[model samples]
Target: MRTLHRREAAAALLALPALALGRPAAAQNSRPVRVVVPAAPGGAIDVIGRIYATRLSEKTGSPWVTENRSGANNTVGAAEVARSAPDGKTLLINADIQLMAKRVMRAVPYDPITDFTPVARLATAPLVLVGNPAGTPNGDLGALVAAMKAAPDKFAFANSALGSMGHLSTESFKRRAGLDTLVVSYRGTAPALTDVLAGQTALMVAPLGSALPHLRADRLRAFAVFSPNRSAQAPEIPTTAEAGMPDLQFTLWYGLWGPKGMPAEVVNALNAAVREVGAEPAIRARLTEQGADPVDEDAAGFARFIGTEAERNGRVAQEAGIEPE
Candidate 1:
C-alpha cells in the first residue's frame, strides 16, 4: 500500500506543472501569449502589433496580449524576449531594429540572427525620397543626382534613426550614386521631416505615410520612392527603378519571434495563426490603411530573408563606418 501511495504521489507531481498553469503544454497554446512590441505605444508599429494580437486571439481561440517595451532603441524588450523560455507563451513583435541591434548599440545581449526563432514577417513599410523645396525645386531624380554629384558637399541626408532601414537605404543609395554625402540622424520622423521642411537638411528618405501631408502641401519635393513599385497613397512618385536607381530598395519591416529552439510544432502553430489572421480581408485592409503592406512568407522563408537583409545591412554599416553607441 505504501508503495502504491508513493507511485500515486509521483504521478501527482508530474501533473502539477500542467495543472498549475491551468493548461497543457501541447501548443503552449494553453494560455495567453504575451506579444511584446519593443517600441512606443503609437505609430504604425504599435497599431499593427495590436491588430495582430487581437486577430491572433480570435483566430486561434487563444488569448494574446501586446505589451509595449520601448527602450534602448528596442533592444531592451528584445533582450528580455531572448532570455524568455522557448514555450511560445512569451513572444516578441519587433521591427527590423531587432536585426541590427549589435550593429547599433554595444549592450545588446543576444544575437539577432540566432537567439530567436523566426515566426512570421508582419509587414513592410515603403519609403519615399524627398527633398526640401528650397533645395530641389524641380523634383527631378536625374537633375537631383547630377546636382548632388556636382556639389556633394552641399547635400546632407536626414534619417530618423541611426540604424533604421531608412538610414541604411540612404547609405546604399549614396554608394550606388557614388557620392559621399553627409547623413544626419534624428530622434524621430517628425523632427527629421521638420528639419527637411525648414531646409535645415537637404534631403530625407521618409515613410510615405509620414511624409504624405508634407508632400501634399508641397513643403517637400518627391524625388523617388525607395520601393519596387509606386505606393498607392502617393502614386505620383516614381519608384527607385523608374528613377534609374534599380539596385536601391529597402523597407522597414516587422516580424514575430520566439525564443531559440522552440518546439517545431509550436513554431508552426504560431506561424499558422499569424497567417490565418493576416489573411482576413478586414485585417489586410486595416494594414493597408497604416501605410504598411502585408507580408506572406513562412518561417523558413522569413529566416532566409533575414539572413540576406543582415548581409545587406552589414555592408551598409561597413561602408558608413557605423560604430555601436
Candidate 2:
C-alpha cells in the first residue's frame, strides 16, 4: 500500500506542471495596451492616436489607451515608448517629426532605428505653404518663388521649430530654387500660424490638415503643396511638382512602432489590428476629413518606408547645412 501511494504521489506531481502550463499567463492579455502620442491634446497627432486606440481596442478585445506626453518636439513620448518592454502592449503613434527629424536635430535618449520595431504606417499628408492673405506679395507658387529669387534676403518664413519637417521642407525649397530667404523659428505651430495669419510673418509651411480650415475660410493663401500628388481634400491646389518644383515633394507621415525584439505573434496581431482599424469606414472618413490619407502597411513595409525616409531626410539635412540643435 505504501509503495502504491508513493507512485501515485509522484505521478500527481508530474501532472501539476502540465496543468499550470495549460492555464493562461497572469494578465498577459488582460492588461491595457498603451498608445503614446508625442503631441498636445488638440493636435492632429492626438486625434490620430485616439482613433487608432479605439479601433485597436475593438478589434483586439483589449483596452487600448492614448497617453499624450507632449514635449521636446515629441522626443519625450517617443523615448518613453522606445524604452518600453518589447511587448505589443506599449506602442507609439509616432509622427514623422519625432521618429525621423528629432534624431537629426539632437542626440536623443534612444535609437530611432535599432531601439524600436515598426508596426504600421498610419497616415500621410501634404505640407501646405501658407501666407498671410493681407500683406503677402505673391499669390501662387511661381510668383512666390520669383519674388524670393528677386530679393533673396528680404522674404522671411516662419517655422514651428528649427530642425522640424516643415523647416526642412522649406529649406529644401530654398536650396532647390536657388533662393536665399530668412527663417524664423517659433515654439510651436499654433503661434507661428497665428503670426502668419496676423501678417506678422510673411509665410509658413504647415501640414495640410492644420492649414485646410484656414485655407477654406480664406484666412490664408495657399502657395504650394509639398506632396507627390495634389491633395484630394483641396484638389484645386497644385502640388509642388506641378508648381515647377519636383524636388520639393515631401509629405508628413505618421505611424505606429514598439520596442524592438517584440514577439512575432504580438507584432502580427498588432499589425492586423491596425490594418482593420485603419480600414474602418468611420476611421477612413475621419482621416479624410482631417485631410490625411490613411495607410496600412505591415511591419516590414513600414520599416522599409521609415528607413527610406530617414535616408532622404538625412540627405536633405546635410545638403541644407542643417546643424543639430
Return the TM-score for candidate 1, rounded to 2 decimals. Answer: 0.79
Global Cα RMSD, each model: 6.9, 8.8
Any idea how many clashes model 2 has? 0
Scored by lDDT, model 1 comes in at 0.78
lDDT (Cα, tens digit) per residue for candidate 2, span 165-238: 89889899889888788888765566677788888888898878878889999999998889888788999888
Candidate number with greatest lDDT: 1
Tell me the whole-model lDDT of each prediction, alpha carbons only.
Answer: 0.78, 0.75
- TM-score on alpha carbons, each prediction: 0.79, 0.84
